[model samples]
Target chain A: MPSADEIFAGLMQGAREEAAELWEEAKEFSINTCWSLASQLVLVGQAFVAGEFTKAEVTKYLETIRLQFIATLAAALMKVEGLAERIVNAALTAVRDAINGALGFKLIV
Target chain B: MLRAIVVLLVVLVVSGCSSFQLGERYDKSLDDDLSAFQIEAVTFVASMRLNSGTPAGAFTSDAAKAFYPKASGTLSNIVVKAGLLSSRQCPINGIANSIGLPTIKIGGETIAADTPKTVVTGNCAVVTLLALQNVLADLEASHRDHQKIGPIRGQLAIDDINKAVATTLSGLRAKDL
Candidate 1:
């Protein structure tokens, strides 16, 4: 039978790899969104200065962009938070199961 | 017509500048929340370490004795880094102030103006907390299965561990706000 320690070691190794992958994904999404928002803002500013857009039109455009940026940020943050919670819960359950399997005692959380 | 163009230019520049400032403020707020979560994590890990005192006798299996301390140390280091990231002042705050930009000190050491650092730090805390919980679980299990190995002094109760984990997890969630 594999020792409880060995089981935990293996589980944690897997958990770390998973966490790193999630982090990288979030990072990429954030960078892309920031760049896109900046580009859109610059284009809007250029149009406003060129008199192509009225002040009211520029205001509406900026507001829309702002709202979109906020939404994207909120979604990304939620995804990362959810991932963290899942990782923690999964680790606890895995350890509990490994120990129970090894010792044959029902371990209650 | 020229006057109107200049007026439009000023409006555009001011509005654009203000929007960026607002974004920076939002990012700072998020960073502050992440720092708070990091502190909470550190406290929880410290409590776990305190509860896991050296037992009177050796563990029954060589693996138990070898892995327990190693896992504990690894968890401790992760918590420390998270704490540092939270408590230190962001290097960007000062630079932003000098450049006439609105500056908010979101306490943390991260690449300048990077909000993803907060998410990364929070995830790191989660990973460490989970690993610590696993180690504690393994120790408790080993103690239960091997009576001859004797008791681990100050060994944490399962209830206490569960409670701490719950608290830490909630704190991490709260940081999303």
Candidate 2:
């Protein structure tokens, strides 16, 4: 027999929980991106160390590095597939408001 | 005949100098590139961090100003020195240079030093990326109880930066984008 306010609160809590869950996923994707880029860089280094790279080879490797970072960050936001942009967006909104409060910005709609 | 030969030799010698032909990448530029990459990587991580206010896709909007080629300079230097980021490389004489490796170029810049002309490599942006990663790891390790951005929970300001870059590249793709 929860009161009206209690029911409203319950609904709000559920929404927040859902938002948090979505944010968690986007965050994980970002982390995995960082790690993967780092790992790929190491592999490129190994190839270079082994005297296995030509001038063209090195250029290609660097291109890959640039692309990975661009792709990872872009994918996180663009919602092209395999990622939950909505969750990330929701979590980020919370951060923006907090940052605005702490940092003291005149945020508009 | 002797004069012609001397002229030919000089041409040969001059053309072989990689430093003369390549872009003058200073420690500053290398630093700039790696810092940009690190910032991109971390901010993306930040979205998953302790952000309670940031909206989805807002990471870019929030970070657009702070995200750019100029902003990530110092962080990149640290990463390259640390060997944490190793993928970004430079192409030399048709070969891929190893990333995250340290290199001191006394001869690569267009503003030449008093040294012999050579395609000096190492200590590049890729190397800087690695070093920055180490700094990040250490920072993460030391601040075991901080409220800073977690591994994947922080709002990484990447979208804004990437969009700007992508737009620029799309314009320049045919011209080596």
Candidate 3:
């Protein structure tokens, strides 16, 4: 059987890869949201200036858009945190498995 | 002998791992509720799109009023269940607060950004459901204000709400083991 140190090194490498994946996901989400929000808000403003939407209508729509942005950001944060938690748990489980394997039994279960 | 050494190693590992409890565990019911809600919400928005610029889709019309009660009930159920599953304090809140918005300058005018009080919990379910409630509120408000849903706005609303729910569902489905 492989030594416990070797198993840990392998597991930590996996965790590092997961973390990098999460970072990429977070960046993509941020970029998309920023672009969408800015472009949508600009359109809303242009429509208002063109008299297509009333003052009250524009106000309501802006509020809706703001709330939507918040909601979207919150969802992204939850996803990032959820992925982080998974990485942590996976590392711990790997540690447990390594110990059990080293013992030639399920000692850590 | 060997048993004692193994026991010590196991104790060390467990103790080190236990304190890092990160987010709420997956709840099958919450997942089901969200999926059901997403379908209902998307269908409702699509219906609005189909009937855009018509009285049939007016907020004050009987057709629209009929959906309010059941939709609100399901949303409230989701919010309450998520709250029950969450810890009193969630780590997401802290992270959000730390990443608070920076002030922006527009046309040489300094506009102070609003504080980042967006996320209130580490529980993905709670974070998602509450945001969904706000989106629904916006939909209701817009419908009431505009009298009828427009095609473009209806499409946008569908996209916004769908994205919000879909991301969190992806998170909740994270592998448990």
Candidate 4:
């Protein structure tokens, strides 16, 4: 049978891997979002330079974009927060189980 | 070539204006909030360490305690970055609407319109503030009880935060500017 320490190590390793994977997904999402925003800015810029769009219009559009970006970011971060919480819970549980197994007592968390 | 030059100059000038600057301010504020959240998270983990006596200059193996704090930090960083990414959605849609551009399709997902911009932005701020408040509350509770946070309860709090944020983004679609 694997020692409690060994089990703990394995669990921690798994948690780390899971967390890393989620972070990567989040990063990719961020890059894609930036690209999309950049494209929009380019299009808007083109219109304004061509005398098709006025300064006031550009300002309004930019303000709207700014608000939208903040809202979107908040939502994405929340998902990451959920993942972190799960990882922490898993770590805590692993610790509790390891301690219980070693000490032979049901310690209340 | 002349058109391209004009377009480039326009992009610089427009993006450098007050409106774009205000957006940058909001982005900074959001980052500040996330940083505060991260500090609270780390403190919470430290409190857990104290209650459990598994590490933090205790008798428990140093390796185990070391693992948690590092894990917590990494998780915090990832969540903040992801949140920043999600914030980009609103701006993309807003720009599209302002210019009468087509809906932005990204990552196999079509960005559409759902809620009013003011309403959505207001809700986003509220949810973020609430999440921070929740973290503060949890820290206080942990200190008062003199115990590590229960895993189940911690998970629930996290779920609550996530739900609050998700609600803000739900039903979002491109609107006509």
Q: Which candidate wins on DockQ?
A: 3
Candidate 1 or 4, higher DockQ?
Answer: 4
- Residue lDDT tens for model 3, A17-53: 6668675645555555555655454444444444434
Candidate 1, residue A95: Cα displacement in angstroms equals 2.3
User: Candidate 2: which stretches are off by over 4 Å?
Assistant: A1-27, A80-109, B1-177
lDDT of all predictions: 0.38, 0.35, 0.62, 0.41
Give the per-residue lDDT of model 2 (tens digit) for A11-37.
455545655867565555544444444
Lowest lDDT sum, 10 consecutive residues, model 4 chain B, at B17-26
Tens-digit lDDT string for candidate 3 (B1-177): 867755654575767654234455667898899889889888987897687678888887787897777889998987788777656554445554455443322234344433233445535556655556766876787778777767656766676677667756765665232
Better of 2 and 3 by DockQ: 3
Q: TM-score of the A chain in candidate 2?
A: 0.42
Native-structure RMSD, model 4: 26.7
Docking tier of model 3: it is: incorrect
Q: Local error of candidate 2 at B21, Å? A: 50
lDDT by residue (tens digit), candidate 4, A15-84: 4566686756555555444444454444444444444334444443443444445445554544444454
Question: How far is B146's C-alpha from truth in model 1 (Å)?
Answer: 80
Pairs clashing within candidate 1: none
Positional deviation of residue B124's Cα in model 4 after best superposition, in angstroms: 6.1
| Model 1, span B47-122: residue lDDT tens | 4334333442334345445545664665555455444434433223332223321111111211122111111123
**Lowest lDDT 10-mer window, candidate 1 chain B?**
B17-26
